[model samples]
Target: MSKLRVAVIGCGAISKHRHIPEYAANPHVELVAFCDPVQERAKHYAGQYGAKAYTDYETLLREVKPDAVSVCTPNALHAPVSIAAAKAGAHVLVEKPMAATEEEALAMIEAAKENGVYLMVGHNQRLMPHHMKAKQILNAGALGKVLTFRTSFGHPGPESWSVDGRDSWFFRKDEAIMGAMGDLGVHKSDLIRWLLDDEVADVAGFIGTLDKAGTDVDDNAACVLRMKSGIIGTLVASWTYYQGGDNGTVLWCENGIMKIDTHPDDQIIVELRNGSIERHKVGAIATNEKQTASGVIDAFVESIVTKTPPSISGEEGMRSLKVILAAFESQATGQVVRL
Candidate 1:
């Protein structure tokens, strides 16, 4: 079989850290192209990979004619690039928050469907080893009836990691569309729903630009969510954790409490009513300071090779994106926003 010819659009931090390396490592993939508005960035990756580089994605799509493309651009560019890729008969693996709005998400989905191409979103949290283990335990009824939960993801903001530092598009409202909620909260929203196999019925939250300066987007957000199964929980995402990053989730269940990603060595800790505590060192999750094999690139390639839909389909992406959108709405209206 011919190897899957893959191209990466937007050679930014995500492409540099995750997509490019992972794609290069995949045996079934050939990194054929790299696209970015910055000529130097595109040329650097292309030179390293022995691939073609282009400054515009439209031209890259036309010239390279890749089998798939990873849309690693800013949040606002996700929809257009994805839609154009699908329309050009290429599969799309878009970054989280899928698009700037529900309408754009739907449009991207439609374009992919119309073109008969698979559309996957990069919500790598679900593919984390510990997170997958947590899902299995929950599915097997090990945690019993989950009552409530709390999930948080915070770091020192994108300025520390983004290629542009403090001036990265992450701080721009027009490019990023949102702040930490879109950046980190959306991942938790998707993770919770996948772990519990439930939908968010309603959400209320407060979001603000508390610490970050010269940015219009919120840097901190705390939200209350109620799942369709009556499971209530709290989700927090922030870019103001000056000390260190925290990506943890605690589940309060009827039989026991499950703690995930809360410890440095032991990734999962389960405490039962009978006072038995279990610790499992599954693995470390990907962090801003550390990069791990996310499994998203592999899964995306597997989906194309096997002609199967990705686990994080565009529809699923839209569903997850809705939670963040609702939270934003709730913050603006000061009322619970129904999904």
Candidate 2:
């Protein structure tokens, strides 16, 4: 079988660290092209991979006609790039939050559907081993009825993660739109919804740019969510965790309390009401600084090869983005907003 020709749309930190390397490593993928407004960056990757380089993504799409493309551009460009790739007859794997707004996300979905191409969102948290196991346990009724949950994702900030450091587009309102909420909160929203098999019914929250200086985007966001299953929970995303970072989730259930990534030693811990405890070591979660094979690129390749729907579809990405949008609305109006 011919390997799937893959191209990367951006040469930013995410593209350099995760998407490019993973695609290059995939045995079933042929890294055929690289694109970035910064020609040097794209040329560097293209040269290394022995592929074509272009400053214009449209030109790359037109010339290469890759089987799939990873849209790793800023949040604002996600929709346009993904839509273009889809319309050009290529499957798309767009980064998280999918797009800056719900309308754009929907448009991306529609484009993919119209083009008859797979559109997967890069919500790599779902690909984490610990999260996958948690989903299995919840589905098996091991946790019984999930009563409540709290999930948080925080780090020092995007200053250290982006290619441009503190001056990156992540801090610019026009580019990122929402900060921590869009960047980290959406990941938790998707994970929680996937784990509990429920949708957020309503949301209320506080979002602000409390810590990061000179950035218009919020650095901290704390939200209260009520799931359609009648389960109430708290979701937090912050860029002000000066002490380090905390990316963890805890669920209080009828049978027990389940904790994930809360401890350094154990990746998952479950304490039952009947005096039983379980500890699992499911490997470390991938971080922006520490690059790990997220299984995303491989999964995208397999889905295309087998013509199966991706695990995280475009609709799924839009649903997750809706949670963040509602949280922002709730923050603005000081009232709970329905999904």
Candidate 3:
């Protein structure tokens, strides 16, 4: 079988660590081109993966004509780049937060639909095994009504991802949009929505810039979401976390409470009303993404060939981005924003 020719734009940490490696790993994908404004970085990708390198994205799109492209650039550039790829007749897999704003996100979605190309967002959380298990339990009524739940995702900032290290666009309002909210927060928003199978209706929130090394955007975000399913919950996303653990989501029902993360043995633990706790050993999702490093390339390639929507579609990405936007607006206005 001829492999899916893929062009990767942005030779950043995500491209280097996940996308490139995963494409290289997948038999269905042939990494044909790479683009980064930095000539050296593009050349480095070419050298490593035997791909054509271009500093110009349009040139890569026009000449190489890849079957798919990964938009691994900054949050703000997501829409423009993905739209360009879709217009160029390539399926697009854009990184999360989709875009910095709802308008931009919708533009990307529209471009993909207009261009008749498959558009998938880089929300890999939907593929996590433990989270899926928890969702199954909730759906099976093991978690009962799911009255109150608290989900969080935090890290010690994104210095590892910045070309300028801790001084990159991630801290800038003009480029990165919102700090932790755009980066870490969107992941949780996507996760909770997928888990509960509902959209967020209103959010009462608080965001602070406390305890971070960089600027303007808040490194910490805390918000309460009112789900359309009548489940009210709190979501916390922060770039101020220290040490190693990225302690995450907890769902509480009348019968029990469930906690999930990448812990060694007790990755997913459930506490029963009778005080008995059950522990499940869960490994991370395997692919090309920011964290979990899950198999996004494989899925994207499969979708392109099969004419199927990916696990995370552009519409799903738009939905998650809206939640983040609503949270930000709520924080700014001191009034809950309707979605």
Candidate 4:
């Protein structure tokens, strides 16, 4: 079988940190094209990978004609670029917070369906080992009738992580629909929804400029969610966690609590109701430090070859986006937004 040829769009931190390095390491993949508005960034990646690079996506798409492309661009641009890639006969794997809005997300899905191509969303939290194990235990009734729970995903802000950090496009409302919600919050939202296997029915949230970022978007957000199955919970996401602390997600089920990103060795800690503790020593997928993008990319390739639905599908991406948008709407209206 011919190896899958992949072009990576957006040569920012995400592209460098996860996507580019990942594609380079995948033996079944030939990283042939790199794109960025900045010519130098693209040139750097292309030089490193010995691949072609272009500042224009149209040029990359037309010239490379890759089998797939990873859309690691800004949130607002996700739909248009992904739809274009699909229409050009390439499968697409877009980063999380699939699109800026539910309408755009629906359009992307429609485009993929029309093109007869695979459209997977990059919700890697679902792909993480400990998270998958927790879901398995929850699915097998390890957590009987999950009641209420709460969790968070926060860092110092996008400025620290993105190629530009706070000065990066992520802090711009035009580029990023919501700050922590879209950038980090959506991960936990998707994680919880996937872990519990339920849709968020209603969401009430508060978003504000708790910091001096001076951007129209939020730096911190908190919400209480009601699931379709009546499992209620609270969640918080922030970009001001003091030195990028509190980047963890937790689930409090009826039987016990499962925590992650807290302790190094105790990645998965299961505290049973009967006072018995279960510890699972699971390590994260070996991420190419230069980029954590490969594990998910490899998984996407395997899914395509096997012709199976990904753990995080385009629909799942839409569902997660809905929660965040609903949260934003709830904050604006000062009321619970029903999904």
Candidate 5:
């Protein structure tokens, strides 16, 4: 089979670390184009992979006509770029938070459906090995029923991870939409929702720029969520974690408690109510410090190749985005916003 020609839009941190490298490593994909407003950034990746570079995504889509496009741009550009690629008959793999608003996300989904192309969101958390195992255990009824949980994602801020450092679009309200909520909260929201196999019915939170001076976007967010199944949980996303990153989730089920990515050696720990403790080292969870193959790129490629819907479809992306949107509404109104 001929390799699927893949183009990556936005050559910054995510593109450099996850999308570009993963596409290059996939045997079924060819790095055919790179697009970024910063010509140098696009050219750097294009040169390395022997692909063409473009400052404008529309031009890249028209010229290369890639089979797949990875939309790694900022939150504000996710909808437009993905829609354009879908209209051009290319499968899309957009970064998390899918879009800045509900309307934008729906439009991207419609465009892909109209063009008969796959629209996958880059929600890598569900694809993690440890997470996959937890899901399996839950499915097997080992945990009985999840009652409540706590999931958090925190780091020293995107300045350390983003290619632009302190001046990165992450801190800007216009570009990033929401800071910690969009960057980190959305990931955990998607993860917890998927883990429990339920949708968020309501949410209440306190979201603000507690630290990180001169930035309009929020740096911290703590929200309370109640799922449709009556499973309650707390989610915390913060960029003010000065010491290190924390990406951990604990599920309190009827039979036992499951802790994930909280221990250094064990990726998963299950403590039963009947005095049983199970420890397993499934795999490493990807973090800013320790980057790993996210499995998103490969999954997107496979969906396109097989002519099937992506695992994290645009609709799935929209549902996850809705949770964050509710959190924002909850913060604004100081009430539990129902989804």
Candidate 6:
């Protein structure tokens, strides 16, 4: 079989760190083109990969005609770019917080359906090794009816992660739309939804810019979530962890308490009501610098090659983004927002 041709849009931090390298490493993929508003960025990546580069995405799509494309652009650009790619006859893998609004996300989904192309979202947290184990244990009835849970994701801020550092588009309200809630919170929402296999029924939360001055977007957010299964939980996303970072979850079940990604040494820990303790070392979560091979690029290529649906479909991404958007509304109204 011939290799699948892939192109990457937006040669920003995410593309530089994750998508580009992963795609290059995939045996079934041939990195055909790179696109960025800044021609230099695109040219740099394209030169390194021995591919073509273009400043305009439309030109790249038309000229390259890749089998698949990865939309690594900003949140606001996700819908239009993904829709265009789908219309151009290429499968799409879009970054998280799928689009700026529910309407846009729905439009992307519709475009993919109409074009008969695969549309997957880059919700890599769902592919974490520990998270995968947690889902397995929960599905096996080991958790015994999870009652409540708390999940949090926080770091110093995106400034360090972005290519432009402090002036990155991440802090700009017009470009990003939402800050920590959209950046970190959505990941937790997606993870929780997948782990529990339930939808978030409602959300009430507080979102604000408590730290990191000179930015209009919120640096912190906290939400109270009610799951469809009658389970309640708290989801917190913050950029105020100046000292370090914490990304983990804890589920209180009838039989035991399951701790995921919390401990320093172990990836998963379970403490039973009967005083039994269990610990498992799955692996560390991916960081920008020490990124372990995320299964994303490989999975996308495999799905296209085998003609199967990706695990994290556009519909699933839309569901997760809805929860985050509802949280924003809940904050604005100072009332619970039902999803």
TM-score of each: 0.99, 0.98, 0.94, 0.94, 0.99, 0.98
lDDT of 6 by residue, 1-339 (tens): 898999999899999888998998888988999999988999999999899999899999999999999999888899999999999999999998899999999999999999999999999998889999889888888669999999999999999899989998899988888899888999999999999999999999899999889999989999999999999999999998888688999999999999998888899999988899989999998976577877888888889999999989999999999999999899889999998
Off by over 4 Å in 3: 284-292
Model 2 scores a C-alpha lDDT of 0.92
Tell me the alpha-carbon RMSD of every candidate. 0.7, 0.9, 2.1, 2.1, 0.8, 0.9
Go through the candidates in order and give each one's C-alpha lDDT.
0.95, 0.92, 0.84, 0.83, 0.93, 0.92
Tell me, by lDDT, which candidate is best.
1
The residue-by-residue lDDT of candidate 5 on 1-339, one tens digit each, is 999999999999998889988988989989999999999999998899899999999999999999999999999999999999999999999999999999999999999999999999999999999999989888989779999999999999999999999999998889899899999999999999899989999999899998899998999999999999999999999999999689999999999999999999999999999998989899888888789999999899889888888989999999999999999999999899999
The ten-residue window of minimal lDDT in model 2 covers 287-296
**Order of all candidates by TM-score, from best down to worst?**
1, 5, 6, 2, 3, 4
User: Across residues 21-140, which tens digit of lDDT does each residue of candidate 4 receive?
Assistant: 677777788888889888899889889888998988887888888999999888888999999999888999999889988889999999988988889998888877777777777788
Of 2 and 3, the candidate ranking higher by lDDT: 2
- Regions more than 4 Å wrong, model 5: none
> In model 2, how large is the Cα lDDT of residue 84?
97
The 10-residue segment with the lowest total lDDT in model 3:
284-293
Colliding residue pairs in candidate 5:
none
List candidate 6 stretches off by more than 4 Å: none
Looking at model 1, residue 188 earns an lDDT score of 94
Q: In candidate 4, which residue ranges exceed 4 Å CA deviation?
A: 284-294
Pairs that collide in candidate 2 are none
Q: Where is model 4 poorest over a 10-residue stretch in terms of lDDT?
A: 285-294
Query: How many clashing residue pairs, candidate 3?
Result: 6
Report the C-alpha lDDT of model 2 over 52-119, residue by residue, as the tens digit: 99999999999999999999988888999999999999999999989988899989989999999999
